[model samples]
Target: MCSLAPHPFLSLSKPFTKRTLISLRNVIRDSALNKPGILADSSASPSRDAAVLIPFCNVNDVPGILFEVRGKTLRSHSGEISFPGGRIDSTDKSFLAGALRETREELGISPNRVEVLGELGPTEVNLRGNMRVWPYVAFVHGHQINEKGTLDTPLSSIDLEDVWKHRSLEEVASVFHLPLQALASPVRLKASKFRGGWPYWAVDVSDLVEAEKVEHGDGEFVDEVGCGQEGRIEIWGLTGWYLSLLTRILQIHS
Candidate 1:
């Protein structure tokens, strides 16, 4: 007892020692935050760094994409269906890290498990102010939902399996039910000379059917065209830009 009391201050590091394990974890986290590089896109504002992860998996044995409906509490694009992502953190190693971290936080996905395919085009939005959004694609072969019935507070989830998988162009047409025609692809994007700082870019959906027909064919693949605000397909705004990029990728892949 006397020997034990004398040596009380000295002890072997025990398994799962709180201090040692916690300190090790912190070291790993710190290292990860220090990596990543800058963007080549001048449109990408370093002052307001952000990124988003668009995840896809095999559904109905076909590629299925994941989109999130933003929470109504969000300032601008509240309740809009989109990808999972947020602003870049000082601790983030790079844009990719920021995106992965945001996805894990928002959707309870393990970042390590995401096989990053690569980065896609970036979209800029003027929401109350200005934002530069970078999108990355990743393949999630395996996913597990937490105790909850779904992952996080899903605004709504749609499985493309029976709903849309392998459906003919006729099915696509019937779903949106918008007028289809061969309209010249609208110059969807334009850039203006920067008089002072960054150059400004403009996007217009003046030609919706034309854009859709660029891939779907002349009223052959699609059923209808959404018009005014009542239509299911919105051809203007940030969502439109995202759809444009997605269409391009799909066309190339197909």
Candidate 2:
């Protein structure tokens, strides 16, 4: 694996502080609110509106991001790794509300457990190139206050393997946590045939996790995985592009 530039979060000798979180939030907020072009193009209207949550948390006093693997049985983007979100529903109040609602539906995670920070910006996808995806940043609370107003155990204290035991099998295959430091120095790969003729950069995180075999069909198994406890996950396409932007932001601020 080729090494990229050193990540500030990993280089730091001390753990992240409230100041670090503030700076990161400021960066995302400024990028989302100030950069109008990043949000959308007024001349061309989007065919569909969607939103996603870039959920992060403090694990063992270190910063980490959460990702979900789409179920292989799903019709669209099956077995792919992505953030916990979906298209905005009619009953939703706003894009933010839709994102949080989808998170709950996807992972059984309560919307109340997430502390909304800001958005990263919007991105377009699909063959017709009409789907608009809005990415938001939020911090996950360690402990969730119960519906009856009772305090529960910290979520971070739960075992990683058991995190997805209760998730909807029809939507999510598994959930995984990746350290911010590891993502900071991801290996870069190229793909020339992604989404038709569009060229794109793919982030290779093979070194970060153990590889597992997956059965495709007809007794054939592929040594590939998703961003979870045990598997080889390939983070590419629009998601990779968004992560590229995040790495740049972190590098600049670091």
Top candidate, metric lDDT: 2
Candidate whose TM-score is highest: 2
lDDT agreement with native, every candidate: 0.43, 0.63
User: Per-residue lDDT of 153-253 in model 2, one digit per residue for the tens?
Assistant: 22332235545776777888767776766665434243423455444445556664444577777899875445422343567666765665565555522
In candidate 2, which residue ranges exceed 4 Å CA deviation? 1-17, 32-34, 38-44, 144-159, 186-201, 207-220, 223-232, 252-254
Q: Can you give the lDDT of residue 126 in candidate 1? A: 42
lDDT value, candidate 2, whole model: 0.63
Q: CA lDDT of 193 in candidate 1?
A: 26
Clashing pairs in 1: 35-93, 173-222, 173-223, 177-224, 178-224, 178-225, 179-224, 179-225
The C-alpha RMSD in Å for every predicted model, in order, reads 19.2, 5.7
Q: Give model 2 RMSD, 1 decimal.
A: 5.7
